[model samples]
Target: MSEFLRSRRARLRPRDVGLPEYGGRRRVPGLRREELAQLAGVSVAYYIRLEQGRGRNVSSAVLDAIATALRLTSAERDHLMHLARPVSRRLRPVARPQRVRPALQQLIDTMENVPAYVIGRRLDIIGWNRLARALLGDFAALPPEHRNLAWQVFLDPSARALYEDWDAKAADVVGYLRRDAGRNPHDPDMASLIGELSLGSPEFRRLWAAHDVQDKGFGGKVLHHPLAGRLVLAYETLTLPADPDQQVITYHAEPGSPSAAALRLLASGQEKTTERTLSCSEA
Candidate 1:
């Protein structure tokens, strides 16, 4: 909790929050503890206690005030709540590999035109459909460790060229990972993944240390496929009720759009899947 607060505080500058800045070679990144206390309307000592994780049962009103001072987004605000009031038992489930159900496989197979794949807790691609292979590349082709979404974002050479707004996409992935880390602090695999990424990618290290949080959900992406050209797909992320750690991400192009045409072309000559799984609509 303290680390999250400290990192969040470090990312802010006094001038960003309308506080006057005294130019100097300051060691800390953002507003000082005293400056933040003034902005949040709390005693410096109390705010310090909060930052140090010494406060018990912190009031929602106080947290709200601090959140306002920090200018947190809805996702960041949720992460703050998680860090501030985490349950011991649910902090991290035992590290087990996530799997896709038969019904889920059917669903992916049914959505012939949609590029969809199931991701596990640490963003590992557990399952992918034909269109997903066409769109996201063959996750099965990558080594087990490199099969992770976040890992690929930093390690994969072609990923940067695939996304028009690569930095923004990478930042969002980091934010999602940060949120997951807060929620599942003790997951060993997640911890190892973070350590590896921090050591391997300087950009990942910088973003991870910043303590940004984001809820991964419905979104749109513009991807440039080598064979299919540019595609504008509206994406939706759906969670499986039975397994909360698993998420099915599916992308669809608008009807009659160029993206739709591209999908049609990509699906052409692809094997006709006779079986289908339960889809997002059924869920």
Candidate 2:
């Protein structure tokens, strides 16, 4: 956490970040340690100790103050809290991939009219029913290693071709991933995914450097499905309270909109295909 704080602080520049510099030879860009302490309403000595990891206990109010002073994004604020406190021993691990829990799967299955999916904290598409598959294309068909949203956006040619506005989609994916990375800095899988994408995709690298972060909740997407063509979908992402690391994302179109009608048609076609496949396998 200290390493992360120091690194983030080092990246900011004084004038660029609206900090007035006192006349002196500066050792680095961004606010000096004392200046940052002043801005965050903390003692310079205390801030130094915190940054050096000499102290780990920090109140939420102080953390919030520091976050504001640093202009930390929503993701960064969450990361700060996580790092400052250890996870409770009583808390159980949520949503393992061995099997999508039946209840969650049923919830997704019941959303027959909406394109919905379950995603893990690392942005892995754990499961999706037929409607989601229809709207999102063959995300579930990819190997587990390639099931990551960031990987699909940057590494998969089909995903790139499928989205009508690829660049905006790519930014959103990276931004979301950036937020996750900050929150779970200790996650090796997340680290490996970012490392791999940074090495492989220049576009991902560029967007990542922008330091954008987003909390996962709700957003809008424009998808160009091969069968349904152009559709603007409003999506709501709900975190499963019982499962900390899992979330359900559902897509909806405006009432009586062409996009809504197209989604219905696509869902019907998908159902027919599924029925035929199941029948053949059973036979």
Candidate 3:
């Protein structure tokens, strides 16, 4: 929580928050702790304790005020609330394996040309359709432990080539992981994945430290698919209300576009196979 607040604070400047910038040397970047406290209508000492992770009875109203003062987005505000809430020390039960319902699997399968898949906690690729396999590579061939999108983005050499803006894709993965971490603080498996990524990729380590939190609902992505060539696809992410940890993400191109025709060709298996299988091993 302290790190998150500090990072957000460092991103803002006096001009951004409507404060006068005096021409003089300042010891720290962004607004000082006192300045933020004053803006939020809180005592500097109280704010200090909160940043130090010492506040035990912080109120929602105070949190809202602080969030507003910091100019936090909706997703970031939710992350902040989750972080500020007290954690339970009770031992967590073993996490059950996530599964896609047969009906839901069938639904995605029926969307002929769309690339759709179901991802669970920590971005695990639990289920996917044939088109998704063609577009994103065969998930079934990967070891169950390596079926996570975050792992592939950082460690898989092919993934870097697969996306035109690899840095943005990598950052999105880290942001989702950060938000999930805030919600599931004691998840052992999540901790293990994060540890592995931190050790494997310097880029992952840098983004993880930024503490950027986001919920990827919908976005446009440019991909250079080996089989379909260059494609511009818009993706939609739907979270299951009954199972908040699960999400269905689907990618589709605009109707009558070249990308759409490419999708049809790929779906029909008319194009010769040239894409290599996705592997989790670092190359």
The number of the candidate with the highest lDDT is 3
Maximum-TM-score candidate: 3
TM-scores for the candidates:
0.83, 0.82, 0.92
Against the correct fold, how does model 3 do in TM-score?
Answer: 0.92
The CA-based lDDT of model 3 is what? 0.91
Model 1 off-target regions past 4 Å? 10-29, 39-41, 89-96, 272-283
lDDT of 2 by residue, 1-283 (tens): 6765775787776775677767777767666778778889999999999888787668899889888888887777787776677554356344355356988899889888899888887788888988988788687667888888888889888887678789988888887787666656566788899899999999999988766666757878888787899998899988878776778889999989999999899889988998999999999
Ranking by TM-score: 3, 1, 2
Could you arrange the candidates by lDDT from highest to lowest? Answer: 3, 1, 2
Q: Residue pairs in steric clash, candidate 2?
A: none
At residue 125, what lDDT does model 1 achieve? 88
Q: How many times do residue backbones clash in model 2? A: 0
